[model samples]
Target: MLKFLKQVTDYTKGAVDAARFIGQGLSVTFDHMQRRPVTVQYPYEKLIPSERYRGRIHFEFDKCISCEVCVRVCPINLPVVDWEFNKEAKKKKLKHYSIDFGVCIFCGNCVEYCPTNCLSMTEEYELAAYDRHELNYDNVALGRLPYKVTQDPMVTPLRELAYLPKGVMNPHDLPEGARRAGKLPEEILDEMKETQDGESEAASANAK
Candidate 1:
């Protein structure tokens, strides 16, 4: 009789403890229910994100040298470089350059490998299209020239010469005779001076 009474007491204590735990759980759930929700309504308001975002790529055609630098670097071969004879100048010029956006991985390889500084990545990220072909770009249509450079008249003892665009790595620097063909204005001379100073500073720092 004494052992049975002890077991009953233990069982009763366990039941009370279970009831207390249930009450505490219910309290926590009720408290959460009374508070405001943290869910957001997307498309109406967006959260500001950090930088280091890789967006779409943009091409500056005029700066391109048709060297096939970007085309060769792209792992997917999305950038197509084509050219034909410019009858008026009797020189070969770019004919067709296109990129299929659908297959682009946004790896930035093409932009980095472009020798003419013709390719760059842009921050515009809304890339949506009903047809996949719409995402492609025509090189001639999109390849626009970048900034112009004026050479120094007094320095280097050579005539004023213009440098090629940023991304282009020319086979040979423009001939010295061609450099002397144009007279650089004061403003252009100043710009050239600034560029030279910047380059010198960069070189000095790199050596250090």
Candidate 2:
């Protein structure tokens, strides 16, 4: 019958469409199988942290006014700002500043709200210690500059996700002298300045 033939045709078409979709799903898995492993070995190899990454806090002892601003801004008031009022100079003299890293949450509020540009966030996340008390960083320890992963000779620094080259997901198999996908922060700023200059020139020409 004509009705039976039409039904068979419709069923065959549906089956083909389903098969196509299943093939499409399998294609991605096959593509991924061809790619190399993305595993990064710890201690010997480390991934470079992103530019805006919030990690360990670096403090400047001389720049800190003992204002207790860091303590107030902190959610837990973790910064211990020990100071004495210098009667002769009539200023709060900073004695010893300390931050217990074990108790302190790495919220970066202290770094953000510091009056003086004394506090800054460093990319040093490796703060593992045998004892909890060892984690408490005094002004001296806080002021010390953190070792950069990209600069280390012993460790191999690998880029991930956004830092990787365009369409290249595997960082381990990077070609020498290959650039990142996006423009640098400096490039973006330069573009903004150029745009502003062009706009100003256009406005001046129209006014004249």
Which candidate wins on lDDT? 2
33-148: candidate 1 lDDT, tens digit per residue: 87644443433322222133456666776677778878778897778888887799887687678887788898989888777787876644556899987888676434533211
Where's the lowest-lDDT run of ten residues in candidate 1?
A: 152-161
Off by over 4 Å in 1: 1-51, 87-91, 140-208
Q: In model 2, what lDDT does residue 121 have?
A: 91
Steric clash count of candidate 2: 0
Model 2 alpha-carbon miss at residue 86, Å: 1.0
Instruction: Tell me each candidate's RMSD, in Å, in order.
Output: 19.2, 7.1
TM-score of 2: 0.80
Across 1-208, the per-residue lDDT of candidate 2 in tens digits comes to 9999999999999999999999999999999899866789988999889888788889889899999999999999999999999999999999999999998888889998999979999999899999999999999999999879999999999886778878888878577788888998899999999999999999999999
TM-scores of all candidate predictions against the true structure: 0.47, 0.80
Error of 2 at 24 (Å): 16
- Looking at candidate 2, what is the lDDT of residue 54? 82
Per-residue lDDT of 70 in model 2: 90
